[model samples]
Target: MSRLEVVCPAGTPAALEAAVAAGADSVYFGFRDGTNARNFPGLNFSREEAEEAIAHCHRHGVRAMVAVNSYPQAGRAELWQRAVADAHALGADAVILADLGLARWARSRFPHLRLHLSVQASAANPEAIAYWTERAGIRRVVLPRLFSMEDIRTLVPALPVESEVFVFGGLCVMAEGRCMLSSYVTGRSPNLDGVCSPAEWVRYGREGPMLTVRLGDVLIDRIPPGDKAGYPTLCKGCYRVRGRAMRPFEEPASLDLLSRLPELMAVGVRAIKIEGRQRGRAYVERVVRAVRGAAEQAARGRPLDAPDLRTLMEGGRATEGALARGWR
Candidate 1:
């Protein structure tokens, strides 16, 4: 079996170093602006930082991919274009993109820079994947977090491009780049604005032995005493639906597929991506090391032995995340 490339996240320059040192094959991150999805405060790399990051990755013989993945808003298309230009100028190994127009522009201008279809494009099937691959000359496509093992087995072989799947980190309840629940609560779009439940509007406080969390005016979650409270994301929030209190979307568990690395490899997956560009360097180091070790073992057809990473996961819990079955 071909070895599965362990593509890791690089939220900051420090995180980039952590990932490369931890044996990542490639480290992907976004710009510190509206041009990429994880455009939160204090996260992502500035142009200067990105240059250093690419240089550091190359020194370690690791690929550095820049995420210019956010959709271009009306009249602000140039902003996205400039991000692509900057990525090429800074010597990124590949540009991960979602918008068709931006992809076409990148291919036209920088003919040699590799192109990857971001998960934000939500291309799960063969036709959609083929359309983007043919149109943008895409080298790889990050599959949406909606494919089952059966689905992946059939789809990856038929596609003309290499396939990447999320193995660890956050699991979106909705199809990528299409969630409106966060936008409903906070008038901002994660796909367009690049901030999901933007940190500015998230509020947390103690209320009668319960921790109450609110995104804008909507109270998304109320954690009882002694319960581990998670970050306030509107979709993963506990809501009162049908007169019953339940997490209408998904629970506060992260996607953990360390045990299924061989299954992913057997399914003809070319790469496995770890999410959480908003995570820190320590997170990058631990995850990359653990995954790198496991991926190496899987490639050699050896029994994979890795430490339990539950404490590092979201809400101290983890799920297989649609790889074994459907998310519902």
Candidate 2:
């Protein structure tokens, strides 16, 4: 069996270099614009930076994948179109895309450039995956974080294209590309603006010994003095229902699937992706190194002991997410 390829994140030039040095087979990043998800201030690459980063990845024998995964706004399709062209010009190994029209445009403009369906596309079922592969010639699809191991084991053999799964990093409770909770609070859509709970709208305050977190005037959560405060994203926030405060959607936790590396490899997963483009170089390096070590061990048929990444987890908590049984 082939060793599973490790795909890592790169929000900045430093993060890209760190991922390369840390044993990532590929690094995915986006331009500093709304054309890709994880669009945030001081994150992603400029055109010149992307060119240089791609060259650096090539020098280190690592594939550089560009993300043009956001839906184009009406009368502003040119921005996304330009991103697709730029990725090909920069010699990107593949362009990860979500928008249907943009994918068609990419195929028409650069037929030889490899195309990958971003998880934002949310092509979970075989028919949906086949549509993208057959119609747009997408070579691979990043499976959403919603599937269990059994679902993946069955889905992979049925699909005609290669499969990539998120094995570690932040967990999203909602379906990728389809979430609207952030827009409801911050008026920024992740699908179009590539931002969810954008930092600009986030506010923090203190009331005596309690810390209050808000997203656009709407209180997300309140932490007691001794408790840790998490980023105030609408979905991950605790809410009051039936006169009691609880997290109805999901908690602010990271996903770490190191223990399941062997099972993922056994299911014929081609690549394992680690999510966190908005994080720093230290995050990219540590995650890539850990995942790389686990992948190697899985390939050697060794016992897959879960790595200790508690400090690296969001709010210092980790979960198997939907990959485990009874997630729903």
TM for every model, in the order presented, reads: 0.97, 0.98
lDDT of 1 by residue, 21-124 (tens): 89999999988889999988899988999999999889889999999998999999999999999999998999999999999999999999899999999997
- Per-residue lDDT of model 2, residues 191-212, tens digit only: 9799999999988998888899
Q: Name every residue pair that clashes in candidate 2.
A: none
Would you list the clashing residue pairs of candidate 1? none
RMSD of each: 1.2, 1.0
lDDT of each: 0.89, 0.91
Error of 1 at 235 (Å): 1.2
* Predicted model with the maximum TM-score: 2
